[model samples]
Target chain A: MNFLSFGHYHHDMCLVLHRSLQLDNNSMLSFTLAMRDGQAFDTVLSRAKSMGLAVREGRLLASAKPVARAFSIQDPDRHWIEIILEN
Target chain B: MSNSAFIPPNVLPPLLQKFAPLLKRKWFRELVLLWPTLTRRRFSNKTEDYGVFKPSLVGHFGQLAVYVQDIARSRIWYQKVAGLTHSRTSDPEPHPSKPGWTLRACYMSAKEHDECLVLLEERDPSGKMSVPSGMSFFHFALEVEGNRKEDVFAFAAQQKRDGFHLNYGPVQHNSEPPDGDGETGGNVACYLYDPDWHNVEFCGAMDTIENYRARYGDKKGSDRN
Candidate 1:
């Protein structure tokens, strides 16, 4: 299984922090999205709740460069998504 | 000299330690001035990282990826609908979680569009395809540059005629809400489902999270400065 890959976004921009995970032995390629579209981070969380999306465990992600508040969620398709905002 | 001074320096002094490394760096500005002689001297071909933050890492919209149960079927569907051709597959990346194995990946580009879509799949020993379920990625948009959004809609309509699953319309998505006044500062978009359930979208706009949020969320305005 070699076709699983992550879609890299536009090159001219930036993400405050990022990380990835491999959930499948051969066919699955997944990433925990700690950053989002230009919307504010907390607003994303609140909107997610309003949409009835499940928010999983949350913890402070510590990095020397930037401090981030993060949480996880599972979509209808069972894909786990992590939302993060740098504080 | 005292015992401390007797320890003759092999490395630079503490104050020089940091700048010494910078002076020896390949991307260092002074090195370019020295390169005329340095290259002739054949000091070293190795290049240095100018900064830890690199725009090249995220440079360019590389690929719009989606999940597929059967790659061959997906390929045929894309070819028929969007006139996308199989550009190439890259060497499998080392599986992040699995040991002694690699992940398979390929890039397919449209003749009309500069960007490509990444198809990720896996095959068993018996040659049967295994697809992972539940992709978290909402949708990816293709920029309309020289190609007109009207042309995109026409092509999408034709795809429907050609028997592809045209899930949604060549309609203007509302910028503020799920359904609102149709003054779309957002994107003129159409949605399609591949052979698998991967939701693919074509938008007549450039790459922006504002576009993504407009389609997927309730927010009308962008918070980014």
Candidate 2:
């Protein structure tokens, strides 16, 4: 599983921190996310909630620190949205 | 460090030098002409560097996101399997259809820093946002900074503790082993499986955090920034 093998993002960058995990021995790939703003986090979740989506774990914005914030959620299609608020 | 001199090929060893027209073969002459032409063609095109093709939309990426399912299960799994320590969570609130329906979510991150793991609630019924598409791009990396190699290894070890084994490089990570370069610090990273089977990789550049702090401390730092 090559890290750069990942398709790059144009308008937005994935800012790959490092290689996380390889799935299906190479079929699917998974990694974490660090969103830019808390508002971005809010906007994503709010839209999903508006679409009548099911909150996977009912856990969003689970933790907060002086410099950063961390939480986990799923997208409408079941993709995990790992939100991060770095100071 | 003296002027070294080397004799020329030991008097040109008696090898096949083909000094007559009989040595000229039709196929060999044709090959000689074709080689340089092909070599010229190989370097003539100006193809775009596909490697730099951005994955997200212009200004729309790092902004757009859709919700999915399996909240509670994903949360616990992320914490235990992804080395995430709880930071905070939102209080339960009413969901639209299931009035009086409570919506709860928590925030978690790695021990080395903050905002490493961000778990949100899917809240969608049809599950249209995050389906795993063969054409779809994978998730984001945490872009860790400082002591990156150490941090990545630690994260990997933690994943082992959580019982999530990878297929390559100890964590199924697909990249070179940590080199302790100051640029990325230590290519630290690990992976985990969310409840819905979405793969999540946590990683960071060695000195990214410190570089950021030094360059723009207190400035707004996001994917866009």
Interface RMSD of each: 18.0, 14.2
lDDT of each: 0.45, 0.38
Instruction: Give the residue spans of candidate 2 off by over 4 A.
Output: A1-12, A15-87, B1-68, B91-104, B109-118, B124-137, B143-146, B167-188, B204-225
lDDT of candidate 2 over A1-87, digit per residue (tens): 121212222112322222332222111212235544677656656766788765443223222233365445544333445444545
Lowest-scoring 10 consecutive residues by lDDT in candidate 2 chain B? B1-10
How is the predicted docking of candidate 1 categorized under the CAPRI scheme?
Answer: incorrect
Model 2 DockQ class: incorrect
Report the lDDT tens digits of candidate 2 across residue range B1-225.
Answer: 111122112111223222212113334433544765676732211111123333321112122221224445555665665546766666644432333333344556566654344344433344332232222234434443343556666766766775664322222121122321111122344544344434455664432334424543453312112
Question: Which has the greatest TM-score?
Answer: 1
TM-scores for every predicted model: 0.44, 0.36
Task: Please list, in the order the candidates appear, how each scores on TM-score for chain B only.
Answer: 0.53, 0.40
Q: Alpha carbon lDDT of residue A42, candidate 1?
A: 69
Task: Please report, as a residue range, the 10-residue window in candidate 2 chain A with the lowest summed lDDT.
Answer: A2-11
Task: State which candidate has the highest DockQ.
Answer: 2
DockQ of each model vs. true complex: 0.03, 0.08
